[model samples]
Target chain A: GIQVEQSPPDLILQEGANSTLRCNFSDSVNNLQWFHQNPWGQLINLFYIPSGTKQNGRLSATTVATERYSLLYISSSQTTDSGVYFCAVPKDGGSQGNLIFGKGTKLSVKP
Target chain B: SQTIHQWPATLVQPVGSPLSLECTVEGTSNPNLYWYRQAAGRGLQLLFYSVGIGQISSEVPQNLSASRPQDRQFILSSKKLLLSDSGFYLCAWRTGTITNYGYTFGSGTRLTVV
Candidate 1:
């Protein structure tokens, strides 16, 4: 089983500010994903980055598999972005589809 | 395009009462289904996952159980609920392969037990 840990369990930012969230895994992973859990409890998939970097609008993610870590960047944050951001990796690092999730980084964007 | 649906956006159940949560996936067949729970201010915990009909794998040991009676249906059930079971339960679906795609979660069901 791989251990996933997130940094800065709690964060607060002003609207239009930028923030970075990190996820560290204890072992190598074949699957890694970033998700945003909105206020209404809807988990939206942000990115699926096993390695390398990817960008989606104001949000982007980079995964360094060799270093066993990943970073999620949110630029020009908005009130709607106030929620919990979670990064997950496969429990077995295989094709089991069992995801091991981090505690998450709770972000609060004040307007 | 595939979509996942979960029932009863919220629920309040008495201790020792039975519980059943249903999740269905549309526009896809033979997809992998999963059940996860998140306690207050806690992270998502994987409870169960199914690769196909009647194939389920439990991740944690608890009073909770899951069943996949159909290709696209996953059910979470408890014979008797416990107060500790109160949390946000989410259902998710992914393709058979674990690579190249992210898992899509449902809106989630907030359950409060008294």
Candidate 2:
């Protein structure tokens, strides 16, 4: 079993602002993903970065496996970007790719 | 492309009642399926996951159990429900490969046991 911790726990931002969210895992992971749970509870896939960096629209994520930490960057934030951001890491080298999630950071972007 | 669906988007049942939640994956075969539950403002807890048909691995020994009858079908069942079982249940699936990626989660089911 691996432990994942997300920082801040909650965040508030104004439209056109930018913020960074962090996630740290206890051990190496084979797969890592960033998810955005909207106000309506739809889990939208943001990134699947096990390593390296990826960007989509105004959102970007980077995972430093050597450091066992990942970061999600939301630039020019909009009201629609307000929700819970989750980081999920899979068990290492296991037959099952079971993801252990961290208590997400709830973001509120006010217009 | 794979899509996971969980029935009864929202449910309310009394304690000691039978509970059954079904999940189905379309557009893929032999995909690994997982069942997770999240309490309010908490992380997703791994309840059960299946690598293949009839092979389920329980992560947390709770009142819930999971079954995989078909390659792309998963079910979570309980002989009797409990008040503590109330929460948000999510079903997800991914490809079964050495290099796995992010899973696609279902719309999620909000179950409230009174």
Q: Which candidate leads in DockQ?
A: 1
Q: What is the per-residue lDDT of model 1 for residues A1-111, given as tens digits with 9 covering 90 to 100?
A: 689999989999999999999999999988898999988889988998999999999999999999999999999999999999999998875576788999999999999
DockQ, 0 to 1 scale, candidate 2: 0.76
Q: Residue A35 in model 1: shift from native, Å?
A: 0.3
* C-alpha positional error of residue A13 in candidate 2 after TM-score superposition, expressed in Å: 0.5
Question: Which ten residues in a row are the worst by lDDT in model 1 chain B?
Answer: B94-103
TM-score of each: 0.97, 0.95
Candidate 2 TM-score for chain A = 0.95
In model 1, the runs with Cα more than 4 Å from the true position are B96-98
* Per-model fnat list: 0.90, 0.76
In terms of docking quality, how is candidate 1 classified? high
Q: How many Å off is the CA of B32 in candidate 1? A: 0.3
